[model samples]
Target: MVIQEQIRIQTRGRNTYNITGEVSEAIGRAGIETGICQLFIQHTSASLILCENADPSVRTDLERIMSRLVPDGDPIFDHTLEGPDDMPAHVRSILTHMDLSLPISQGRPALGTWQGIYLWEHRTHPHQRNVTLTL
Candidate 1:
């Protein structure tokens, strides 16, 4: 069986929004006892990740490191039509992942105890993002 669903996420700005529960709920609704759950974000400036959920510091550190590696308004990039964060956002998304695949078992996503799924918005301004889930 194949089940597909799309969820809209409103991001405040450049931050990580945890959507683990949402995904799990979707999986439960699908009622797939065992299968592969695929999540795809339909935006270039945003991506997805499975990261440590026990501490918020991990995400903070990731933001700090990503900012340093791909600073906004870098003179090297010429795709600044939107803003300083425009080009960097695309780069960050490329470096990360636009899609994720997780194993579903017992009608839920088989994520680790300390792992959570997040939508990483690389843009500096708020925007609406969409994530498509296929199970």
Candidate 2:
């Protein structure tokens, strides 16, 4: 069986949003006991990741490191029509992943304890991000 759906995520600027519960709920609705769960984010300035959701510091550190690596307002970037964060956001997305594949078992995503799926919004402002889940 194949089940597909789109999940809208309201992001709070540049941050990591845990979407594990939403994906799990979708998986439950799919009723696929044993299969592969594929997730794709339909945005250029945003990406996806599977990381440790146990501590807030983990995400904070990631944000800090990424900001340092891809600092906004770089004079080298030519794509500054949107804002200082425009090119940086795209660079961040390039550094990360646009899709993820997880195992489904017992009608649920087989994520390990302390691990969770996330939408890493790289924009400087809030935006509605769309993630498509296929099970």
Candidate 3:
């Protein structure tokens, strides 16, 4: 079975927002008996990842590590058209991912109990983001 769905999310900015529930709900609605559900983030300034949902601190640490690894305002970056976060955003996206394919079984996404989907907001300000689901 093949399924297509789109979801818009409003971010507070610069953080990972858990979106597992939304993706799972969309998959359920699609009624795909068995397949792989692919998730694509329609933006370069953001990323997609499966993260530990059991603890909020894990997300926090991830953000901190990413920030340190690709801190804003590096002297070598030339794509600062948006701001310091612009180049940093690209770097973060490079380190992470923009699309993910998940196993779907029994009309549900096969996710571990403690694993969750996240939209890693790389921008420095709040904005609306698009999530496309394809199964």
Candidate 4:
């Protein structure tokens, strides 16, 4: 059998926010001995990614790449409900990931030695993010 849990977070966009601990905690609480832990972000403007768990510089580079790929305000964007980053966030999300699947072992997510799950918020301000964990 599988269990599902929703972990909520409010974050300031423009950087990588580590969610490994949160997911692991959820998985631990789920009490699954062996299964796949699936994580999905329920927003078009939000994204998910697996990144380096130890170093912060990796996250900095990721933020830089995002800025270069999706500038704050581009002339091609039409949807700007929240601000300049609103549409860009959608584009970033499209370019990035929306879901992830991780292995579960001993009631925990089976991550590598230096692997971490991150919530990549691309918005312009602080926003609430919902991370759905289906194990």
Q: List TM-score per model, in order.
A: 0.99, 0.98, 0.95, 0.95
Candidate 2 lDDT over residue span 1-135, tens digit each: 688999999998988999999999999888789999999999999999999999989999999999899999999899998999999999999999999999998989898988999999999899999999988
TM-score of 1: 0.99
User: What is the alpha-carbon lDDT for the whole of candidate 1?
Assistant: 0.97
* Candidate 4: C-alpha lDDT: 0.88
Question: What residue runs in model 4 are displaced by over 4 Å at the alpha carbon?
Answer: none
Q: Which stretches of candidate 3 lie over 4 Å from their true place?
A: none
| Candidate 3 lDDT by residue in tens digits, 1-135 | 466889998999899998987988898888777899999999999999999999999999998899789989988899999999999998899789999999988878888988899999999899899999987
Q: Tens-digit lDDT track for model 1 on 1-135?
A: 788999999999999999999999999888899999999999999999999999999999999999999999999999999999999999999999999999998888898999999999999899999999999
Question: RMSD for each model, in Å, please?
Answer: 0.5, 0.7, 1.0, 1.0
- What global local distance difference test value does model 3 have? 0.90
**Model 2: how far residue 116 lies from native, Å:** 0.6
Q: Rank by lDDT, highest first.
A: 1, 2, 3, 4
| Cα lDDT tens digits for candidate 4, 68-128 | 8989889888887788988889989999999999999988888889999999988878889
Which is superior by lDDT, 3 or 4? 3
lDDT of each: 0.97, 0.95, 0.90, 0.88
